[model samples]
Target: MIVTIAGAGHMARGIGNRTLAGGHTLRLYDRTRAKADELAASLGQAASGADVAAVDEGAVAGSDVVVLALPFPAGREVAAAWAGALEGKVVVDISNPVDFSTFDSLVVEPGTSAAEQIAAAAPGARVVKAFNTTFAGPLVTGEVAGRPLDVFVAGDDEAAKRTVSELVSSAGLRPLDVGPLRRARELEGFQFLHMASQERLGLNWSSGIAILP
Candidate 1:
């Protein structure tokens, strides 16, 4: 699969690592071209056999899947901007709408989530809520404490969900199909508590939330 990831931040690195490890071609884009180039080079070094490159925004339309690794607001803005380009693509939203200052509640209105807002912005895209519960640190290796990370997936389209699930599994993580896209509400809520508990639990953003069989 050809995967395009926006933003060259920590989450982008983590997800990019997994994407390359899954043997998929990766194209990276960021507002600052230099950042994207740097990330692309770094990922290429880590996975030498993988096909990867830093590309401009215009190249994003060619991707089979596009992962919006930006924050909630930026994700929504970009989704709106690229709504036409994202049509029929599996677009993954991995953001939690938490207010960083308070860290006690989400920024989005009640009864909705970042994934839902992003979906509405890009009506033609197949939006899926995933990776919000997984931190950047653990995502790089796709595991924690000798166990695979469980990626919670929610999407309205069955095939889109399967695509993401396959990618997650290919990267050596467990993909749990929680339900339809609306279930993003609970996933976002659950991740908020997980984020808040990090400091209290001394997890240092390294913990992984797992569901045992």
Candidate 2:
């Protein structure tokens, strides 16, 4: 599958590396073209390996799956803008809208979540809430605790969830479908605690929340 990651930050690097490791073609895009170019090169140098190339906004239309690896509000903006191009494509929302200043609450409304809001913005796009709980550190290896990283997935469309599930599994990670998109409320809520505890415990970004079965 061809996966296009629409960011050039740490999350983008993590997701891009894993997608490449999964043997999927990757196209990267960022507001700053140079950042995207540098990221693509940093992942690897092989043409077909991981160090593919930076793509433009137009390239997103051709991608099978588009992962919005940006921050909270930014992800929503990009999603809305690309709504037309993302028709029927699996759109992954990996953002946790935490109020960094307060650290006690999220930026979203009481009930809605970033995924849900993004879904609202792009009604035609298949929006899935995932990877928001996973940090960039562990995503590098796509694993934690000697096991694959557990990706919690939530989306209204079962087929979209399945597509993301397959992508997660293919990237050597575990996918946990937590039901419809409404469940994203809890997923986002839980990650706020996870993010808050990151620096508090000085875990050095090594923390991974696992659901032991």
The models' CA-based lDDT, in order, is: 0.94, 0.89
TM-score of each: 0.98, 0.96
**Which candidate number has the best lDDT?**
1
* Model 1, span 1-213: residue lDDT tens: 999999999999999999998899999999999999999999999887889999999987799889999998999999999999999899999999999999999999989999999999999999999899999999888889899999999999999999999999988889999999999999999899999999899889989888898
Clash number for every model?
0, 0
- Candidate 2 clash pair list: none
RMSD of each: 0.7, 1.5
What TM value does model 1 have?
0.98
